[model samples]
Target: MTLSLTELAACFEGVIPSILCTVGADGTPNISYLSHVTRLDDEHVGLSDQFFSKTARNIRENPRAALLVVNPHDGAQYRLDLQYCETVGSGPVFERMAADLRATSAQVGMTDVMRLRGVAIHRVLGLRAVRSPLAAAPPEAWRGSALPRMAAVVDAFADRTELGEIVDAALDALEAAFRHGATMILLHDPARDCFVTLGSRGYGRTGIGADVLPGEGLIGLSGKEGRAIRVSDASRLRRFGAAVEASSEQENRTRSVALPSLPGAMSQIALPMATQGRIRGVLFLESPKRLAFSAEDEAALALIARQLAAAIALSEADAAEAAPDAPIPRRPSEVASPHIRVVHHAHDDSVFIEHDYLIKGVPGRILIHMLEAFLSAGQVDFSNREIRTDRALRLPGLKDNLETRLLLLRRRLEDKNAPIRLLRLSRGRIRLHVAGYPIVISDRKSGAQ
Candidate 1:
């Protein structure tokens, strides 16, 4: 009997690199390695097009292709007879596959070299399980482990009044109940167009306050594309060029260091926290073992992401209501020290403090505005609503995540050991602390139009 595609779902998740066999127009067989085969449905799978020039050429010339996939759980093999149908150069499928491929390439030190040209969709005409003497029994499909208590755990999220409590509870449940090790939650910073690490579990340091640009690393790409990325052997891909491109090496050595990845990570999954067609952040989990997470784990995390997204939205709204209109009393300023020059490059939104890179983009603009406001009016405390309405910030017309941007900016300033600092007074109100450093702002001219 022919096997249903659902029966071989595990093999399609890129647990084991799939082997694709295609015939050239001249009829010579060509084989290529496929890192990602996303299941569109029972009859279709999407393959990421990267380093598949020959495979693409052959498949277009000869529509028939064969794929061999192995189940990571039990080493069982499956063969799929597929027909090359079409290629998607854009949209959700392309973005998802590209993000996965980018993460896969980063693990193997080919980050900058690999680029996803498109996603090739194939029609699976036949699927057959390969009988192997070495095959082992599959792991138990359902573990009454966290599934039973998941409903209660998810419901508890709505009860969380504070964002910190919600984050802590979610991470706590993932570790104590779901058995996830090394997990982190990164909130989105629309102003900066990046994901900033908020909290983490199972790492030596929280890596909190670290910012990752979307489409840079695995976490960044997931957040950027609003997709989930899972890699079985994460350490094997180490190019990390996209991540490094965010900061200058000289700056990392002398000034604030660059953000880091999860320590001792072997396998990892980055899932975007999205709900109501809005992306809030990204959820990342890592482990030191290969194939550490399964489809079930992914499903569970997706549910959690949904719950967290709604909770976060509600919390932010509540915080906005509670925020005060006027700035809090400014703390006594210390004696003014030497002049500190803050340069704002309007071209890229890059900000430099005394030639040391502080932050760029929305956060930089926010800092500039704040410093200007302080210089003009001595304003200290501020609220998310105030920043969101600031005409000078020029925040995107879309739903602005002003709060997360503030968090990212605060963390970055702390990392740089700048004379000015921001303190969170409440969910929405923040108190700014400025040392006696006289601040000077410069608007640098840009070459770009």
Candidate 2:
């Protein structure tokens, strides 16, 4: 039988949570509550265990394993079984797994419930589902180590694809994310200051996505606030009604198409892509399932949102490089902030980078990047040198010209007013001269506009 699992897993967007059966060193197999088993790309699955445990030790001994999951429904007897021949436990692999579990779980109404149990990561293996006798009769017809055919649809995303290519891939991923059967991605049109659905899938004869007003829908909230927002019980919410766009005839068209019935998009997620502290566009994922966005799901989508930002940045950079007339903007000592919108809640600590005193905007941004580079070098070295204008060349044209930018950059550095002056522009070379206490720039990446 088709089992729905994921601790309160969003019926549509919920992350299918599970416990993996692993053979320990003594050859005894055991299981534990796995808060982390999530999709990494389409072909692979990841496992996340908190601290070190028998399950982790089992994976360390032998990577072969099967993750078990039982939903709250299905008479408490049914579960969705995912057979993973491979596993990745520690390092960054668990990052996605842990995040997905948290988001999906949270969406299910259990916030802060995903505890990794502090299991030390043992091994990460690549898995292939071991087919069972009940591989037929549709995915819902059977369970126990069963992987649906649609899992193939997940393989569309890649870490390294052009932004244009990724846009298409993103639309597909969005459909999977929402499981709205099919979905569309609308980018915030900066020129028009409006939202427009750019791509879609899984519909016939009509598509949705007319230009929407700012701060109106989930997509609007994402672009306006620069955070990923998921909406549940869309119909019940007074703010949202039914979509007005039409679906397309092409089942796998590049542009978005409306689903036959909007596939019960009870929950939706909108992620705004940004980089280097600049907002790029929006990635809207709609789900047919109510309560689809679990906390783990939200976290997973947030990571994907970040990944999307990087992908978009890299892709656009590639495109700009390819075009003769289009100039890709890059200056020296420039660091990016993923270009997504940031929440401006007032906290005691500052999120923006600095060198003690308040340094705002790009001028402040450059100095911080420099401080980072120098401090990382160990030992404050620049001393006994006069300031010069050529420092502007280091980060081309934050000012009017190389000469003027240097003057601006140097003045900010001098104003720090610390025990010793670490940075001094001497001759054509910029210097970082400090007497004692190696000056290290704070951990921040602020920008202006």
Candidate 3:
């Protein structure tokens, strides 16, 4: 396989890292992705192998090989088959590769949970570079065909959206985003001063949905410190609390590359979610791979986080607009003081709602927040007030008709297997029948041990 020098150079600049593969003696080929590839001076091209495998061994024995690079987005993948005369490894090179590998894994959410032994290499053979569709090639082909994947996540803010539909779509998209391993949405509860795992994707057998407190584990520290944390090993991190009894809960919460240990959390970027110039919450991404998050990936994720913050703010505004308005319910002068919280026990959980303040495409935003607020505050009996009804009438679409909305809210609460009913009163009062979960106060602690 051969390519014009120009085409070969273009491949080097594409989105997907060029992979160096090696075959074990028996023919089991070990191929992994790479992030760095460059020509040492002018003759040899150097590549990193933080994702240590048998690629080096295979290259050492056969000297015949292939290189693959592709666009990360929806672009065509490209391959190069060539020969390498020698293979090499240096202490610094190994260290650098390992670092890059860990960073890349963190950004994309890949956790191998394997012992990373070391990094190796493949020395390029004679000057016979190759490219795709190689037969007829201009020694100097112009660049354009295969380029690096460029993706930017935008948090769209708008006045109103079809919330139920958008949430349904977003949930599906979120699942796809975390198809590889444990993907979660870490929401900031200013009241609690901690981050909670609201949604999870691809979790392992053990229950990971449990909460974590700030400075309690790896995730917690990131939330508390408001910065990214990296660990090279997990067993040694003192911050990881005692072992959980759950069978799936490993003694070592995360493989260490830095310091703290959070369950299923290693090499994480605790990107804070903020809007209106304030840090409202955080987005904690964990990868079992050491140094999982890369610079480019971090940049992308940071941008996504910014978009998320904007989206949440927009969703909140939209939600406000949707609140009952046909007949404005008398605003209750007394909402149980934000500081007072008590747990009323029922055989079920509290009302669960996703209130992204800024995501515009989601319709029925404001009404939902109010529903959530009522549900969140339900356990404390509203004393037969007319707040709920009055507010429903005031809302635009409700026409003071909160029966349907309440019914839907009730259905959702029941679907979650919650035994408690957060009841609404005459105007806009809300209360709960069974024990309620402790309302998160801005100053309270959050998450599991």
Per-candidate TM equals: 0.69, 0.36, 0.39
**Residue 92's lDDT in candidate 2:** 65
Ranking by lDDT: 1, 2, 3
Return the lDDT, model 1, position 326. 71
- Candidate 3 regions exceeding 4 Å error are 1-180, 205-209, 230-242, 246-267, 327-416, 419-449
User: Best-fitting candidate, measured by lDDT?
Assistant: 1
Question: For all candidates, what are the clash counts?
Answer: 8, 60, 74
| Candidate 3 residue lDDT tens string, 367-392 | 23343455554324332123333453
lDDT of 2 by residue, 18-122 (tens): 556668778897867654444443334445546256755676676666654433223122223344354445456655444444444444434356445332332
- Cα miss at 83, model 1 (Å)? 9.5
lDDT for 55 in candidate 2 is: 59
lDDT of each: 0.74, 0.44, 0.41
Question: In model 1, what is the error at residue 162, expressed in angstroms?
Answer: 4.2
Count of clashes in candidate 2: 60
Report the Cα lDDT for residue 119, model 3. Answer: 42
